[model samples]
Target: MNHFIEKTLQLKDPNITIDTEKVDEVKVNGRFSLIYYGKLSYTPKACECCGIINNAFQVVKNGYRTDSRITLNTISAMPAYLKLKKQRFSCRECG
Candidate 1:
């Protein structure tokens, strides 16, 4: 699992630093979910013209499952990115 996380981080951003401290595991619906918390130097929601900044967003909840019945079964890793918008701010400049 650690290796998978490492590979994911590398694929996401090779230059930015990843906060392992914020990384955590949770059990939901009897399935294991991995959570990652970190800040990207480049903001995805930043306004191109005004350069106004937007509040940080949380990534999506990701999960994976495997079946042991099949011989040499290759279960592809599941990838998901969840973004929750903040309601506190309604910035016209960045909206």
Candidate 2:
């Protein structure tokens, strides 16, 4: 999965991580569109509310946003657009 994304997006170790629980859809015609339902690979090591840096600060999954961006490369010999529904997170202590 990682290899495919790296090759397709031409990115090395991109911070975006796919959510395997959801199925990714790809549309290919004259142009290519990859609808990846995933999340940003972010782990908060500190709490913004109390300025605490420890595991006690609970990180909660907030929601998600559909981010559509143009890719630099083409897929299947066509221009590719990435539609990523990235999951959001928040600190329980702050919110």
For candidate 1, write residues 28-91 as lDDT tens digits.
3565555454333433465445666545443221232221111111123423222112222234
* Per-residue lDDT over 1-95 for candidate 2, one digit per residue giving the tens place of the 0 to 100 score: 75676565665546766544554445556434544444465566776676666486487667776675535465556555555656566776666
- Candidate No. with top TM-score: 2
User: Highest lDDT, which number?
Assistant: 2
Q: Which residue pairs come into collision in candidate 1? A: 60-82
lDDT at position 35, candidate 1: 47
Q: What is the C-alpha lDDT of each candidate?
A: 0.39, 0.58
Worst 10 residues of 1 by lDDT: 66-75
- Whole-model lDDT, model 2: 0.58
For every candidate in turn, the CA RMSD to the true structure comes to: 11.4, 4.2
Point out where model 2 deviates above 4 Å: 18-38, 48-51
